[model samples]
Every structure is written in C-alpha cells, then in structure tokens.
Target: MRSVFLALLVAFFATGVAAHVARSNSLRDEKLTFNPTNVHVKRLAHTPRTLTNAQRLARGLNPARPQLRSSRRLAGRGGPSLTPTTTSTSTDTPTGTDTTTSTDTPTSTDTATSTDTPTTTSTDTTTSTDTATSTSPTPTPTCTAHTGVLELTGGSYNGYVSSETNSFGEYSVTTDASEALQVQYQECDGAVSYGPINFKTLNGLSTYPYLGGIVGFSSSSDNLASNSPNYVYLGGTQESAAGAPPQRGANSFSAASGTAKDYESAIWSVDPTTGAFTAHWVNTDGTSSAPTIMVVQDAIVLTDDTFRFIQTYGDAVIVSLTFAESSSAAVPPQATSSA
Candidate 1:
C-alpha cells in the first residue's frame, strides 16, 4: 500500500513540473513583431524611375492626377513589427479613383535621429515634391550591456496623477497582445492633463495619408485613499472642449512619489495648404466633451492604389500611440524636474 501511494505521488509531481516548465517556456518566447495592425495600407500606382511628369505629358499622356489636399503626418503606436509565421493586416472611404487638384511647393523639416523616415511614392496622376533631412544625436541614459529585446507582454497600464495635493485624469494606454493594432484609451477625471486644449499638427510623411492619435502616461502613488501601488494610463485622444486650453498645458505625471513619472499629449491639425482644420473627436469609448484638432495633408496612393492621409506633431518624448480619423502629434515642451 505504501509503495503504491509513493508511485502515485511521484507521477503527479512530475506532471505538475512539466506543465509549469511548458508554461514558462511559452511565455518566455513571446515577443513583439514589426507588423502594425489597424493600419489602412494603400498601394499607390508605381512610378518608374524613367518617367517624369513632364516626360509623361510630352508623350501625349495626361499629367499625373494632381495631388490635392495639403500635407500632414501620422505619428504612431509604433513598436517593432511582428512578422507572423502566418500574418494579417482605418480611415475614410473616398470613392472613385484617387484624384488630386493642386500644385505642391517642395520643402523639408523632419530630422530622423535613430527614428524612421517616411517613404512616399505616388501614382502618375499625382505630382510630389518632398525633402527629408535626418541627424543623429548621442544616446542618453546609456548602459554597457546591449540586452536584446525579451518579451512584449501587451496589456493595460494606468497613468494617473495624484500629488501630495490633487490629481486629475492623466495619460493611459491599453494594448492587446492578440491584435496589436486594436487599442483603446481612457481619461478618468475629465479633460486630460495635456489633451484637447493644446494640440499640435500631425508630423510624418508629406505624401502618404495617415491617421493621428495621442498616448499619455503618468505614475500614481496610491488610490484615492493615499497608499498602494503606482499605476499608468494610456487614454484616448482628447476631445474639443468649452474653454480653450493652451496649445500647451501643464501635467506632472506623478501621484506623490516626490518625482516625475507622468507625461501629456495634445494633438492638433492643419490643412493641405497650411491652414486651420478642426475635428470633433467622437472617441471610441463614448465621450464628446470637446472637439479635437485635425489637419490633413495631400492624400496619396501607393503603387497598388492604396490610400492614406499623413499628419505630424510636435516632438516631445512620445510615450504611447493614439489613433483618430485626423489629428497631429503632441510634443510637450520640456517639463522641469520634480520639485
């Protein structure tokens, strides 16, 4: 009887150990990919190197359909794209063949320092004028060990603001692991710390169309009660509101740690020819408190005639990515250290 009982116990322990090891191995192998979801990819007609607009017209062909709408950029919920063993893949629906109706004056102002540069290629009907200049600065907060990426456990994080004094709806973002692009944002107490009021124009590529969104974060010391763990939040884009806030606002990204762990994001928009653009952000989560700023650039088609609208934003340290029909990136002016 004793020997039989010992054999049963050994079998059960072995099974449990195997299961635990398998679970750990599975989790440890998980990673983030380079593929982006929710991305409405458009394939514009390819333009061969030999062909120029003037040459096409000279050959008795119509000039490329002129690209109308001004220019903008698409900031992102960017991370390394995940190349799936099997794979998968937003915006308005403009009917009929992609068309343009204006001329473009060429200029450039983007600097890609250890970041990506937008690549633009439009069809024969469109005329494109663009310039890109990139510079690399030194790396900060450096460490000797270059540990490669380990795991990208996509999940929810709350970014709140609760100081020794008061707290407000800070930035927060929630990302799903299964579907990378399907993200939802939330703001708790009302207007975001730097949302809505002070937004900026989108900044990315000049030719390709793109969507815009804002992601925010902050650190919390405790719940409303004043003692617990810190949390982060990646809320949705700010809506247009009543009183006009600064195109720049104030946020500390803290909740009583005597330091800073918070950040704010305000998005705005502009037009194709550099004019004012407005948007009423009907957030995915049912809030129409304020209108969000939205600027649009020349909508471009890819080699396959796919379409997208591009936008841009100010360059603050980007915490998370926001998504919207039309808006710009928010680069918060440098915040002073915690006092």
Candidate 2:
C-alpha cells in the first residue's frame, strides 16, 4: 500500500512538469510567429495576391494599374526653369579742359584861343536964307438963270398951279366935275400927261378933305426927258366939319386966285397908271398945321400960304414931267415953282 501511494505522488509531479513544458513551447512558437521587425520585413517582401481580369470582371473592378503623372509634368509644359539666374554690368567716366586771354589801351589831346577890337567917327553943319512973293484974290462963281412956261387949257378945278407958270411942268389937284378927286399932270404943251388919280378911291384918302395940291415927282436928276414919273404926292386937310363947304380953293398965275380953308393935313403917294395910292405921312400933330404942297429944287416942300418952309418931304419928291420949255434956247435952272 505504501508503494502504491508513492507511485501516485510521483505521477502527479511528472504531469505538472509536462504541462509546464508544453505551455513554454506554445509561448515560444507564438513569440517566433509574432516578431514585429521580422513581420514588417516579411510584409514588405511578401507579394500581394492580385485580381485577374476574369476575377476583376467577376467583381466589377478595373484590372490594370492607374497611370499617374510626375509632379513637374503636372505643374506646366515648356515654362521657365525654377532655378534663379544672375547678370553683371559696367560704367565709364570722361575728362574736362578750359582756356582764357585779355588786353586794354587808351590816349587823348586838346587846344583853345580868343581876341576882340572896335572904332567910330561923325560930322555936322548949318546955314540960313529968306524969300517972299505977292498973290491975287479968287473970283465969285455965277450960274445962268433958266426960265420957261407951264400952260393948262383945262379950267375950274378945286386946287392951284404955281404963280410962276413959265416952268417946264405944272401940277394940280382937282375933281374933274366928278365925285373922284384927280391929280392932273399938265405939260408945257397945255396937255395933261399923267393923272387925275381919284383920291376918293384910295384907302385912308377917301375920308380926308379935298387934296390941296398934287405933284408928279421922282428921285431922278433929269426931269423933262421922261414922261413916267416915279410917284405922285397929294397933300390936304383932315376931314371937314359937318357944315363946312368942301374946303374949296383955286389959285392960278393969272388973277384967278380964290380963298379957301386950311386945317389939319396929310400927305399921300399915288401911282399914276393904276390909280393906286398909299398914305405916306400925316400932319395932325397940331404943333404946326395947314401944309400947302410945293416942289422946290429936288424936294417937295410943305409950307404956309406965305411960302415959308414948313417941312421938306425927301430928295425923291423932285418934279419930273414930259414937256418942252417955252424957250428951248434958254438953259433951265434947277427948275423952281410955287402955288
């Protein structure tokens, strides 16, 4: 029985030893199979299984490897190289030059002089003498007296003719037995040449009294040659009072002088051809009244009955008539007459 028990104990020990040894071998085999470096090298060197066309066709996948480009070929084609390139440059400087020159010169000269002189001379003389003679006196001047006659065949008028009828011409103011007052220019031939101009028809003359006298006169120096006189002068009193008898008067060289009334007076100029007349002047200025008309030399003179000068009308009042002197042989003096 003791032997059997010891045998059983030894068998138990041997089974434990075997079990440990088997466990150690399993560990060693696992370590050898699972080594990291050897496993990596083996994976690197090991060829992977590839799919065939038939196998790829069966799995619906491409069988060939994908063609990929290189990095440079992917960047661009025929472009500039990425490597940097360098360049070298050079410069040159020039030189300079300068030149100068100058010169100057001057000269001058002057001269001057002056002089003066003068001289004079004079003379004078005197003498005396006397002389005398006798002379005669101057003589007095004389002029020839001229004489002629003025005749009138007409009769009984309201005015007068000059007392000296022998003059070359005569003038009178009268009415020709009509209401119209007439200025008669009587020639030496006993013919009336110019007038009997009706003073009643003239303006301003119509209201006056009967004209006292009329004279045909001119400014011309030659009287007896021309028949047409320049103007005829009429002189008379103012309007007569209501009861006065027409202030009638008549005078002649013969003994037929009649009495009349004279008062305020006026003067008029008359045209012989057309019987037109204008009142040239008036004498109602009462300082001197009663103007009797007459021609003396070359002017018409207004006077009192005594033949004293009252007023001279103008040089234009000279009597001019168409007539022959009574004695043609007698040289006429400056032709004077009166009324």
lDDT of each: 0.26, 0.28
**Residue 112, model 2, lDDT:** 18
Candidate 2 local lDDT, 225-311, one digit each (tens): 123222222333333332222233321111111213232122333343432322222222323222333444422333333121212
Candidate 1 regions exceeding 4 Å error are 1-7, 10-197, 200-250, 255-259, 262-339
How big is the positional error of residue 150 in model 1, measured in Å on the Cα after superposition? 39
Candidate 1 on 126-212: residue-level lDDT in tens?
A: 335667999897434211110010011112322211111112222222232221221112222233323333231111111211112
| Per-candidate alpha-carbon RMSD to the true structure | 33.0, 86.3
Worst 10 residues of 1 by lDDT: 297-306
Error of 2 at 165 (Å): 28
- Top of the candidates by lDDT: 2
